[model samples]
Target chain A: MYTTMSSSTTTTTSPSKPQFRNKLVSSLNDIFVFVGGAILALLLLWSFCSFVSPNSTITFNISSPTRPKPTKLVEPTNSETTPPMNCAQNELAHDPPDHTFYDDPTLTYTIDQKPIKNWDQKRQHWLAHHPSLAQPDRILLITGSQPGPCKSPVGDHLLLRFFKNKVDYCRIHGHDIFYNNALLHPKMTTFWAKLPAVRSAMVAHPEAEWIWWVDSDAAFTDMDFKLPLSRYANHNLIVHGWPNMVYEERSWVSLNAGVFLIRNSQWAMEFIHAWAGMGPQTPNYSQWSKTQKATLPDKLYPEADDQSGLIYLLLEENQKWADKIYLEHEFYFEGYWKEIVGSLRNVSDKYLEMERRSTAGGRG
Target chain B: MYTTMSSSTTTTTSPSKPQFRNKLVSSLNDIFVFVGGAILALLLLWSFCSFVSPNSTITFNISSPTRPKPTKLVEPTNSETTPPMNCAQNELAHDPPDHTFYDDPTLTYTIDQKPIKNWDQKRQHWLAHHPSLAQPDRILLITGSQPGPCKSPVGDHLLLRFFKNKVDYCRIHGHDIFYNNALLHPKMTTFWAKLPAVRSAMVAHPEAEWIWWVDSDAAFTDMDFKLPLSRYANHNLIVHGWPNMVYEERSWVSLNAGVFLIRNSQWAMEFIHAWAGMGPQTPNYSQWSKTQKATLPDKLYPEADDQSGLIYLLLEENQKWADKIYLEHEFYFEGYWKEIVGSLRNVSDKYLEMERRSTAGGRG
Candidate 1:
C-alpha cells in the first residue's frame, strides 16, 4: 500500500526522477571526500614546509649540491671569557684603550705633535682628498647680473646672449655654469655682489670643484685661454693684480675682482663669508668705508667696495691668505665695458677658431 | 773671579744702570710670587670642591638649602639577587616571563586568540589612529590629464580650461588640485593611467589626505554640489555605481572609476600597487585577455580595460575591499564627453552664481 502511494505522488508531482540518479548521488560523496582530503593535505604540507625553512621552498628542489650548507652551530670554547656583571662594568670593559691622559709622558699622539695648527697645511690636506677636485670635474660658475639699480648699455636680451656665450665657453671646457639675472644676496651691490653670487653658486653646485665669477660687463676675449690648474696648485683664489698698485702704492683697488677663479673648497666658502660680512650689511661696514678717513686712511677712493675688504683681510689678518691668493698678471681679465664691446668683433674669430679645434679633437 | 767677570760685563753693557732699577726688579719679583701663590691656592680649592660635588659648578651657591645634601654613598644591600654568570645565562634570565611555548598551554596569547586574521578588523584598528584620517585636516588632491593619444573636441588648452573649472569647483568645496598633461606611467592607457597619476599625486602632495581623480573627458555639471566627508566616514574609496549593474548583471562596466575619491592612506597605496600590477606592464597582464577563452571565459569583452580588472578583483577577491568601497548612486559622477561639453553653456550660469555667493561671503 505504501509503494502504491509513493508511485501515485511521484506521478502527480514529477516524472523526471529515476533510481540511477540516486545511485550517482551516492557515488559523488566518495569523490568529494577524496578531493577535499587532497586539498587539506596539500595546504598543511605547504604551511609546514614554509615554517621549517622560510624562502627555501622556491628553489629547494633545483639547487645543486655545491651550494653552501646552512651555517653550522659553533661549540662553546673553554678559552672563552666571562661577561661583565652589570651594564656599567660592560661599558668600562668595552671602552677604547687608545684614549689616554694628555699628561701621560709614556704615550704620545702623532696628530697632536704635528704642526697642523697652520691654516695652509690644514687646507692643503683637505683639498687633496676632496671628491670633486678632479681636473675634469671642476665647475666654473659664470655669474652675470643686470640688477634693477645697475644700468647696462645693451638690452636685457643682449645681456642674456652675452651670459649664454659665457655658458657655451664653459661647457666647451667641460665645466658647469650657473647664470642668474638677479643678485643672489639682497645686501650685495656692485663688486660686492660677486662675493654672494660665488658663495651661493658653491652651495648650489656641490659637485663643482671651483667657482669662476665673470662680471656682467666682462667679456671673454681670450676664448682659447684655458686656465691651467697647475698655476693654482697651492692657491685657493686667482685674481689679476698690477705690481705697482699691489706692492708700491698699496692701493685699495690693487686687485681686480671682476673676473676671478675661486676654489670650491671649505676655505673659499669661509673666506667668502668673511668678505661678505665686511659689506654694507654689517656693523663694521663703516670701518670699510672710504669716508672713514681716520679708520681707513689708505682706502680713500670713492669706489671702495668688496675689493677693498678683501685687500684689508689679506694685508692685516693672516699671511696664509696672501700665500694662497694667486695674483695673476699673465692674462687681461677684463677691460672697460665700452672697450669690451668694441673688441667683441676682433675676439669672435678667436672664439670660432677654438671651437673648431675642440670639435676636431673630439671627433679624432 | 766669576762674580767679578759678570760685574765687569754688566758695567760694560750698561754704563747708566741705577741702584733704583735693581730695587724695582726685586720688589716686582716678590709681588709676582705672592699673586702666583694665591692663584694656585684658589685653583686647588676650586678643583677639590668640584671633585667632592660634581654638577654643582653652575648655581652652586643659589640652590635651595633644602635641596638634598649631595647624595651620600650607600652600603651594598645583602637582599640583592646574584647576577647571571655569562652572556647565555644573562639572556635566559632576561627573557620576558610572558613568552612561552604554545604547547605548554599555561599562558595565553591574546593576539593569537583575537580575530586579527580578519583583514577588515585589522585595517579598521590601524586606520582609526592614523593622523591623516583627521576630518578637518584632510587634503583633497584633485588631478586630471589630457594624454597625448586621446583626442578632444576642444583644443588641449580648452581641455585644460575644463579641468581648471573642475579645480575651481573642488577649491570652492575646500580641496587642493594637481593638474598634469601626460600619464605618469608610460605603459598605462585609458583608466589604467589614473592609477599612476593618483599614486604620483599622493607622493607630490604629502599634505593631502585624499586624492580625487577627475578625467579630462568629465566635467562638473553641478558646481553647487559639495561632498560632505561624513558621506565617506568609514570608506576608503568613493565611486558611483548602479544597483542593477553591480549586483544582478555583475558587469565589468558597472562602475565609473573616472571620477572617484581615494583616501591618501597606506591601504590605498597598497591597493594602487596591486591595481597597477594588473596593467599591460606586468607579466600577469596576459591572463586578462579575453581571446584566451579557456582561462578567462567570463571576461569576454574586447576592451578589457582597468575598469574590468577592478571588477574582476571585486568579484573574485576579498569582500573587505567591497566593504571599504562606497558605491554611491545619489548623483551622476560622469556623462558622455560630448554631453558634458554640450552642457557647459548651461552650467556656466550656476558656476557664476556660486562664485558670486562665495565672493560675497568672503567679503562679509
Candidate 2:
C-alpha cells in the first residue's frame, strides 16, 4: 500500500514540475523582451537628445542661415567621365581685364611638341616658373621736416639746400627721400612732430621696408654711411644711444629721436600709435607730464615730446617694446648748430682745395 | 657797260639775300623739329619708367602670383539669351554632401503662387532675412585654479566645491565656468598663472564675449548678482580698485586682481599676449623686476606677478589700456579666509532656520 501511494504522489509532482518549468521559461522570455525593447527606446531617445543639443543646434542654425537654395543641386557624376573643374581655369575665365599674364602660349606649345630647347630659353622658363627665388626686396624711405612757423636760424635757402643734399645722398645710395615743410599738425612742432611724420610716411610708402626720420637740425657727417639692412633685419626700430647715459644718467635724452629708423610693419605701426597717444593732444598728456617729472628729472622742457614718451615706454611701460628697439652707439647723430656750421665751413674748404689740386694736375 | 655791270651786281646781291633767308628759315624749322621730337621721346621714357617704378612693379608682381591660367577664358554671353550663372546656384550645385539645407521648396512655391498674408510668418521671415536685427550675443566665462604642490589647508575637495558653487551661481545668472587644477607651468604658480589661464580660456571658448577670472581665494558673496554687459560695453577689462589707492599709493597691489573681467576682442587678445611676455619665463622678466623695484618700492613680493605687471601697464605703459580698464569699488572681492569661513556658518544657519520654519508651517 505504501509503494502505490508513493508512485501516485511522484506522478502528480512530475506533472507540476513540468508546468512550473514552462511558466518560469515564459517569464524569463518576457523579461528579456521587455528589457531589450526598453533599451532600444532609451537609445533612440538619447540619440534624439544629442541631435538637438545646444552646441549642435547652434551649429545647425548658423549653417542653415548660410545654406544655398536647392534649385541648382546637381549630383556629382563619375570622376573619370567628368573631371573636376580646374579652379585655375574658372578663376581665369572670371578674372578682370586688369590681370597681367606672364605665360607665353607659343612656349607651352613648343615644349609639348619638341624636346630640344635653347639654354637661355630653359633658364628663362625656370625663372618664370620659380618667381620666388629672388630675395625679399628692401626699401628705405628717408623722411624729415622743417617746422612751418619757426624758420631755421641758418636761413630758409640754406635749410632747403641742406635737405636737398641729404636727398641727393639718399638717392645715390638707392634710398628714397620725402621732405616736408609743414608738421603733420600745426600744433605738433619740435620733438612732437617725429611720431606723426614717421606714421604718415609709413602709410604713404607701404612698400618701403623701413621709414627713417632725420630732424632738420641733423646733418649727415658720414657720406659713406649706409644703414646695413642685414644688421637691422631682426630689429623694428634703431636709435642712437649712449650706454653711459642709459646706465648712469638714465636721462630721457639718452636715446635721441633726432634721427631714428623704424620698420614699416604692423607692429611698428601699432607702437607708433601707442607712442603718439602720449603727445600733448592726447588725454594722457598730463600723465606724461607727471611721469616725466617723476622719472626724468633732467628733462627740463615742459613739453613731454616723443623722446620722453619713448623713454617712458622703454624704461617703464613694456620691456617687449624695449627689446625690439636697437640702441645703436656706432655713429654720432647729434651736434650743436654752431659746431655743425663750423664743420660745414671746414668741409667746404677741403672740397675747394681738392678741386684746385685736381685742376692743377689736369693743367700740368 | 657800267650800267650793265651795276644791274648784274644788283641781281646777284638780290639772289644771295633770298638764299640766305631760306637757309635761316630751314635751320629754325630743323631746330623746332629736333626739340619737339626730344620732348616727345622724354615723355614716353618717363611714362615707361613710371610704369616700371618700384611701387608699380611690386603691385604687378604681387598680382601676377595670383593670376590664373588663361585656358578656360570665356567671353560673357548676352544676358537675354544666356542667363547669367548665379553664384549661389553654382555653389549649391557643387556643395558637398555635409552641407545642411534649410530652404523649404514648398514654402517658396506657396509664397510665390498664393500671396496669402500671415503677419507672424511675415515677421519671422523678415527676422530671418535680416539677421542683424538681433542684439549681439554676450557670453561670460568664469575661471580660476590653485596650482599643484600648493595643497590648500582647506581640502582640495572643499575648494573645488566652492568653485562649483560659484559656477552654479553663474549658470543661474546665465554664464559658463572653466576650472583648471594644474598650473600652466610649475614656475607659473604665483602671478604668471593668471595670464596663461585667461589667455587659454579665451582661446578655448571663442563663443564667450567676456572672460571673468576670479582668484582661488575669492568667493561669490552675492549669488543673485549679474554682470551688466551694457555698462561694460565700452571697456575691455574691469577690475576692483579704490580711487585713493590708484592716486596716492600708486602701488602694484593697489588694484587687486582677485576679480577681473576681460573682453574677447582682438585688442584684448593682443593685450594679453603683451602682458604674458612679462612673466618669469619670458626674456623681459628681469626688466620687469627692475621696473617694479624702481617704480613700486612698497611691493614687498619679489616675484613680478600679473598684478604688478598690470599696475605697471596702467601707470607706466600706454594710457589707452588705462582708458579701457574700468575700476570698480562697489563690492568686496576678497576677505580673510577665516572671516569667510565664519560668514559661511552664519549663512548655513540662516538657510537651515528658513528651511525649518517652512517645514513647520507646512505641518501646521
Candidate 3:
C-alpha cells in the first residue's frame, strides 16, 4: 500500500522548458523512476494568483441580491436539534448580522456537482465576515487509506505509522488534520481517491486557505520543517519533478503525485477536475491511458495512472498548465524513502547543531 | 488488544449505593465481563459544578500580582519562529488587550509539575477575554494508540478504523478531535497512557471545557448520536459500571474505565494524579496491586491496572471523588462489541422507521 501511494513521476522543469519530443524523447534514457516512493510526489501549492495583489480576483460580486444580510446575530437556541453541534462556529460560536457565502443558497459541497465558481471571492467574502480566520496562511491537511483492513498482514500497521507521523507533525505545528477511511467516490479507487477527497475538503473547510493532500505512505520525516509558501505565490499547484524527464523524454515517471500543496481556489477545483478526468472512474479512461502510453513510450504500465495523467497535462497542454505547476527540486519535498532513512541521522545532527548554535547566539 | 482496551468493569451505583461486604459479596458471581468490548467504556463528562449558578466559582481571584493585563491585542509577528502554526488562536487570530491565564508566567502545562490551582477562574478569565470560545458547552475529543506498529498485524488496522470512525463523528458534530501516538509519559503505558495525554490536552486546549477520552478499539457504532451535555452538566468525570460490584462484591470488574468524558478543571487535575498514583509509573504500583487484590478478592489479575485504580478511588476515596464521577448506564455508551454488532440492523431499522414517521409528520 505504501509503495503504490504515488502516481506522479519526476519532472525537473520549472525554468528551462523541455523541448517537445513527440516520440519517446531519447534524452531521458538514464532517469529511471521506481514505483515505491516515486508515487508519493509532492505538489507544491498556493493559488495561482498575484500575491502582491489581494484585490485582483476573479469571482462573483460581493453584492448578491439574493443573500440579504441578517439583521441580528444568529445564536443556537438548541444546537443539538439543528445539525447536532455545527451552528454559528465563528470566533464566538455565533454568526454576525453581516452575510457571508454560507448565506448563498446555490453553493454545493458535493464533488459530482457542477464545479464551484468564484470560490476565491466566496472564501474572501466569508473571511471578511469572520475576520478571525483572515490571518495570512491557514492550512488543512487531508489524508486517508483504503476503506477496509489491509490485505497485506502488516499493511495497516505501516499505514498506522504513516498516519501517526502526520498527526505528530500537525500537533506540533497546530494545523488541522483530517483522516478519511471511506471512499468518497465509489469508482475512483486506488490513486484516484485523493481527488474527490480534496474537492470535498474545499467545500467542507471554507475557513482554510490551502488544502494540503499527502499520501498515506508519505510520512513527514522532518517534523520541524515548514513549507515555503512565499515562493509559490504565483503558482496554483506545486509538485517535485524533473521537467526534462516529463517534456523532453516524454517519460511518464517525470513527476510524482504522492504529495502536493493546493490552494482552495477556483483554479484548484478546475485543475482537480481536469486531472481526475484521466482516472478509471471517467468514461475516457481507456483512451487517456492509450494516449499516455503512446505519447510516452518509456512508460511501462498499461493503464492510465494519475502521475501519467499529470505529466500528460504538463506536456501536451504545456501552455495551459505547466506555468501554474511548479517542479520543485531545490530541496527534498518528498525524497525517496531509502535515501532519506539512511541520511536522517546526519540531518538530525545538522539540525541539532544549528539549534545549538542559535541557542549559543541567544537567538533561542 | 481490543479486549484489553477496557480497564473498568460495570457498576450500577449512581443512586443506589452498593452495600459493602468485606469478603467476596458472592452477589457478583454471575456477572462475568468478557474483555472484548467491556474495556470500551464511555466516560460521560461535564465540569462538576452547579449548572444553574454560572457565576459561582472557586478559583484564584481575578486579580493576580505578577501578571498584568496587556493594553493592546497581540498579533503574530512571525508564527514560524516561535511555534510553527500556533499563536493567537482565538476567533480573530488575535489576543485582546486583556489578561488571561496565558499572562501568568508560573503556570505549567506538564503533568509532572505542581497541580494547577484555581483553574476555573483562570479558564473563566480566559473565556472573558475570548467571548467567542465561551459557548454553553464545548468538547474536545481525544484518542490515541501505541506509538509503534501494532503487535497484532490487524491491531493498527483496527485502530485506524476506530480513529476514522471518530473523525467522521467529529466532522458531523463539528467537534475538534486529537489523536496522540507518542507516550506522554514513557513509564505510563496501556490504560495509564491516557492520563498524561488528557492532562496535556487540558493545557493545549484551554478553549475546550470537556476532554473526552475514547479507547482506540472502541468504534462509534452510531454516527449520529450526540452526547447529552446537559445531562452531565454537574459532573466532571463519567463512566459505565455497577456500584455493587465495586463496593459490595469487591470485584475488580465493576466500572469500565475504557471510554470516559472528563472536564478541564482543577478537580480533574487532582483526580488524574490520584488515579495515576496506582500505575506502574508510580512507586506504589506493587503495594497498590497487592492492596487491590486483598480488597477486591475477586480480581483475577495480579497487576495494578487503571480500572482497579479508578474503582479504588471511588471505593476508598468515595467522599472525595464519587460525586464528581458519574456512573452512566442509560444507553449504549461504549457497549460490548459483539452485542452492538448484531443489534445494529435492528437499531438502524428503528431509527429509519422513526425518521419515516417524522418526515410524514413534516418534521423533515
Candidate 4:
C-alpha cells in the first residue's frame, strides 16, 4: 500500500552531557509515548476519513484492475490429469470450486497474479472449499470481539457468503460436510488461550488445505486473490501480515495482519506450536519501556509489533528459511481508500455482470 | 542465554559518492537489505543466547534449585464475599481440565475475581456451578518445515521434557506427519512446510491449551516449573526460553519458538482467522539472492514465523492487555541449560517430592 504521508519527523537532539544519558532514556520513553500518541492520532484521522470521507484520495499507484481471462476450459485430458483426488481439482467443473486454485490448480500462486475477476467466483470457490478444507487445514478465525460499531453483519455475511456455496466438504470431525455449526468463541490475546481453538478447528477439518482469516472490516477487492491465496497456503507461520511499500524508517516497514495468510502444513503448525509453546524467552517487562536512539537514518526501524518481537523471530527464520517468509505488496493496500474502494466496487460490478452472463449461457 | 562474543566486526568500505544520496529513493530496497540484516543478526544472536542457550546464565541473585513454589491455594473463607458476576471468569477459564487446566472436573469451575489465579481454591469451589467449557482449549505448536540438521524429535523432546509433568497435558506432531499424509505443501520457505502437521494435530485435539515448543538442542534446568506452567496457562503466548542477565548489549529478548506458548482465547482465535482468511503479506522475493553480501545480510533478516510472528502478534495484544500480558525475567543459575542435565536429575526428583508433599498435605 502506498501513501504520501510524511515520515516520522526526525529532529536530532544534541547530546547535552554525559549525565544526560539517563535523562535521555527517560526522555526517549516520553518521545515513544508521544510517537505512540501520534500514531494513534494518525490512525484516528484515518479512521475518521475512512468513515466520514471514505472516498479520500491519496498519492499512490497500485496495480490497475486489469487481468487476462483463461482462454478456454479444457476437459480432463486424462484421469491422471483431472481425476478428482481428495477433491483437489481445477476450478472449472466443481459445482462451486476451490477459490484458492485460481482457474488452474497448478498455478504457482503469487500475490501479483491477477486471474480472479469477480467476487461471486471468489466467494463461491471459498464456500465450496470451506467445508472441504483438508483435515489439517481447518482454521479458527479469532475475532477481536470488542463488539464495536465497526463489527457488523457484513463480517458474518462475508464468511457465510464465501463459504456456503463454494465449499463441498470440510474437516469437521474428520467428516466431509458442506457446512457445520459455525463455532463462535471469545477472543484471547494470549497464545495459550488461542491454541485449543486453533487446534480443534484444524483437527475437525483435517481435509482443509488452508485456514483462512478475514478481518471484520475488510471487504474483498478483486484483481485476483487466488495467486496470493495459493502462495500464502504454502507458508508455515503463526503470523504473517502485509508490509507497506512506504518506509517510515529503515528498521520498520508498515504491517497489517488485517489480511494475511498462513500455511497449515506441518512445519507451519510447528511454527505456531513453537511460538505458543512453553519455555519461551520472555521479554523483560521492567526495562522494555526504555529505549536507545538509533544512530543512522538508514537503520531498520520496526513499526510497533514489528519492532517489539518480530525482529527477533524474523532474524531466526532468516537463518533457517533465508528468503522464504514475507509480506505481499499487492495483496495489502492501505492508503488511497478512494482508489481501492473504486477498484473494489468496479471489479465487483464486473463480476456480477459476468455471473449473469454465465448463468444465462448455461454450464458451458 | 548469555554469550560473551560480539560478531559486529567493523567493515571498511569506500566513502560513498554524493550521488548515493540522489539514489537514496531508489536504493531503499538495497539499503534495507543491508540494515535489516545487521540489526536482525544482532537481535537474533541476542535472542538465541537469551532464550536458546540452555547453558546460558543471567546475573540475577535468585537461588539455583529453589524455584518458587506454585502460589499457595487461596481458600476463600466466606462465600458471601465473592465479587460480582462478570464474563471475565469464562474468558480466563477458557481452557478445560483436559489440556492446560488439568484438574478434577469437580474442582475446575469459574469464580468472581479481579485478577484470577490458576489455582484459587475459592475460584475452583465457585467453578462447580459453571461447568460450561463444552469448548476446550488446545495449543498447536508450529514451525517452519526447514530440513536442517536440527532434528525435529530432538526439538520435540526438549519441549516434551520441559513441560512433561508441569503442564496439564500436551501432544507433539511433526512435519513428517503431514508429509506422510501427502499434505506437504508450503508457500514461503521450505521451513513453512511443517505447518500442515501441526494444524492437523490441533484439529485432532480441539480441547487442549498451550502448545509448548523447544528447539532440538535447547535444554531446561530449573528449580521447579510450577510458576512457568501457571504463567503459560495464564497469558497464553509464545513465551521465551530464558534470558541472560549478564548480557548488556542485547535488548530484544525472545525464546526460540522451539520453546514458546499459545492461548486458545478469543484474541488468538481472531489472529488465526485473519491469517487464514486473508492471504498473508508476502516477503520481498526480489531480494531472494541478497543472502550473498555479508554487509547486506539476508533480505529475510527477521524470519516471519513462529517467534517473530508471535512477538509481533502479542505486542499488538499487549496494547489491548498491557498489564495482563507479561514476559518473565532471565535468572542467573537456571537461565537456559549449562552442564546441569544429570546434575538437575535431583531437582526433578525433589520436585516429585514437593508434589507428593503438597498432595499429602491436602489443600490445607
State which candidate has the highest DockQ.
3
Cα displacement (Å) at residue B311, model 2? 78
Tens-place lDDT per residue, model 2, A207-301, is 34577776543445433234544556688988777767764786875876666788766567567767777777676788878877678777765
Candidate 2: the clashing residue pairs are: none
- Can you write out model 4's per-residue Cα lDDT over A85-122, one digit (the tens) per residue? 22221122222322243334344222112222342344
DockQ of 3: 0.11
Task: Please list the C-alpha lDDT of all candidates, in the order they appear.
Answer: 0.40, 0.41, 0.58, 0.26
Q: How far is each candidate from the true structure, as Cα RMSD in Å?
A: 40.3, 46.1, 13.6, 28.3
lDDT per residue, candidate 3, A95-131, as tens digits? 5555566556677554566678888888888777766
Q: CAPRI band of model 3?
A: incorrect
Candidate 3 chain B lDDT trough over 10 residues, lowest sum: B44-53
lDDT of 2 at B193: 58
Better of 1 and 2 by TM-score: 1
Better by lDDT, candidate 3 or 2: 3
Query: Which lDDT tens digits does candidate 1 get at residues B1-364?
Result: 0011000000010011122211212211100000100010000000000011111111111011111111110111121222212211111112122311211323211111211123333334433433222234345444444323112112232233233345434422334444443334445544565676676555433334577776543445443233545557798877766656756677654666666788766667666766666677666677755522222334444544566666655666646477788876654444333223333443344334544564455322
Question: What i-RMS does every model get?
Answer: 39.5, 37.5, 14.3, 29.6
Candidate 1 regions with alpha-carbon error over 4 angstroms: A1-137, A146-154, A181-183, A290-304, A337-364, B1-364
* Comparing 3 and 4 on DockQ, the stronger one: 3
Better of 2 and 4 by lDDT: 2
lDDT (Cα, 0-100) at B105 in candidate 3: 69
In terms of lDDT, the best-performing candidate is 3
Q: For model 3 chain A, give the 10-residue run with minimal summed lDDT.
A: A44-53
Per-model DockQ against the true two-chain complex: 0.01, 0.01, 0.11, 0.01
